[model samples]
Target: IYHVNNWYGVGVGSVVFYNDAIDANTDRSLYRKDHVYTTADKIRAGVALNNEFKFGLITAMVDWGVYLYNPARHYYDNPEHPIYGLGRRPLFYKNDGAGSDEAFHYIRFGMKTRIWDNLYFSASAKTHLHICEYVEFGLGYQIPFLKKENRKHGEKIFHHRKNWWQE
Candidate 1:
C-alpha cells in the first residue's frame, strides 16, 4: 500500500500595453491602455501497489488531480477626452476572482521480470485523462556497487530503492 500528495500555485503580474499616439482632430483618434493578470492552483492524490507473482512482478497505481486556473483577466482604459490621452484611470475591468475550475485523472500499470540473476526488464502504460497519454518500456541490468559476497540480498534491493531523493 502507498499514498502520495502534491500541490502547486502559480501567478503572473499584471501586463500593460500602450497604443501609438493618434491625431486629436481625427474622429478615429483613440488611445488604448491594456492590463492583464493570471493565476493557477493544483492538487493531487495517488495510491500504488506492488506484488510479486509466480512469473514476474505486477504494479498498479492511480492518481486524481484538481486544477483551477484564472487563465486571464483583462482591463481596457479610455480617455475622457481625445486630447487628454488615455491614462491609468477610466479603465473597465472584470475578474472572476476564483476563475474557472478543472479536474484531471491518471492511471499507471507496470511489471518487471528478472530474466537472469543480473538482468531485468520492465514496461509500463500510463494515461492522463485531460493531459498527456503514452506507454513506455525499459530494460536494465543490476551491477553490484559493493562486493556481492559482502552484502545481504535484502540490503542490495533496499540500496537500489534509496538511490535518489525526489522533490
Candidate 2:
C-alpha cells in the first residue's frame, strides 16, 4: 500500500547571487562609507529530484546547484570596533570564507501537466522553509531525436500514474 515515485535529471540553469552590503561611519572617515557587492552570469549545474504522491497532482522536488566559480567581485563589511576602530573586512567575497561555497540549495513543491503531446508547462516555488525565493513558471517542449511514434517509452510513466509510491 506504499507508493513512491521519483524522477532525477542533470541540467544547467542560470543563477544569480545577491551580495549583502554594509555602511558605517568610521572614526578616521568623516563621511559614511558605503559598499555594494554582487555578481552576475553565474552558471549552476546540479541534479534535481521530484517525488509524487498517489491520487494527487502535487509533486515535490529538490534541487542542489554548485557554482562553478566564485563571484567576480569580492564583498567586504565595515564592522565598528571600540579598540581597533571601524575597518572593512572581507565578507562573502572570499571563495573560502564562511557560506561562500557558491552553492545554492532549495526545494520546490508544485505540479506540472502537458499542454500538448510534446509541449508541457509547470509551476513551482523555490523556498528555504521560511522565505520564498521566487515563483517559477516554466514552459518546455519535448523534442525527440526520432519521430514521435518511434520514440521509446520508459517502463515507469509518471504522467499516467496515479500513485508514485505504489509497488
Candidate 3:
C-alpha cells in the first residue's frame, strides 16, 4: 500500500506611481510611470504505488499528481492611471489581496534493480502534462553496508532497517 500528499501557493504585488502634477489643462502624456500588482494560487494532490518483486531484488513505483486553479477566486484586474489625472481624480484603491490562479499536473514512474551482490541501480522519469509546466529525469546507484572480506580487525557489524519517517 502507498499514499502521498502536497500543497503550495504563489503570489506577487507592485505599487503604482504618477510623475506629472494634475491641472485643469494638464497634458495626459505628463505621466512618466504607473505601477500594478499581481498574484496567483495553486493547489495539488498526489498518489503513489510501490511493489517489491523477484524476492526483493527488484522494485517498481508510479505516482500521479493533479493541480487546480480557481480563476474567479484569483485574478489580477488593475488599470493604469495617467500622470495628469493626479489630484484632479479621486485615487481609488482596494485590498483585493492577490489576483490570478494557475494550475499544473504531473506524473512520475520509476524502477530499481539489485544485480549481483553489493550493486544496486535505480531510475525515474517525471513530467508535467499541462500548459506552462516542466519535466525532469534522474538516475542513481549506491552500495550500502558493504564490508571488506577476510578482515583481521574487530568483527564488523551491519544493521539494516526501513525508514518509515520518509513515507
Best by lDDT: 2
* Poorest lDDT segment (10 consecutive residues) of candidate 3: 2-11
lDDT (0 to 1) per candidate: 0.33, 0.41, 0.32
For residues 51-117, write the lDDT of model 2, one tens digit per residue: 5443333334444433334332222222443322344322222323333222234465666666554
- TM-score, per-candidate, Cα-based: 0.31, 0.45, 0.26
**How would you encode candidate 3's per-residue C-alpha lDDT over 1-167 as one tens digit per residue?**
21111111112222121222222233433222342212322222333323322224455645554323222111222244342123232222232222121223335556655543345566665543332223333344444343445322232211122331222
Ranking by TM-score: 2, 1, 3
In candidate 1, stretches whose alpha carbon ends up further than 4 angstroms from where it belongs are 1-107, 129-132, 156-167
For candidate 1, the TM-score is 0.31
Residue pairs in clash, model 3 = 16-35, 74-100, 75-99, 75-100
Q: Which stretches in model 2 have alpha-carbon errors above 4 Å?
A: 1-33, 37-60, 70-104, 155-167
- The candidate, 1 or 3, that scores higher on TM-score is 1
> Clashing residue pairs in candidate 1, if any?
none
lDDT of 1 by residue, 1-167 (tens): 11121111122222122222122232331212232221221112333223232221322323232212211111222344343234432122221122121112234545666565457677766544333335667787867555645554333432233332220
Would you list the rank order by lDDT, best first? 2, 1, 3
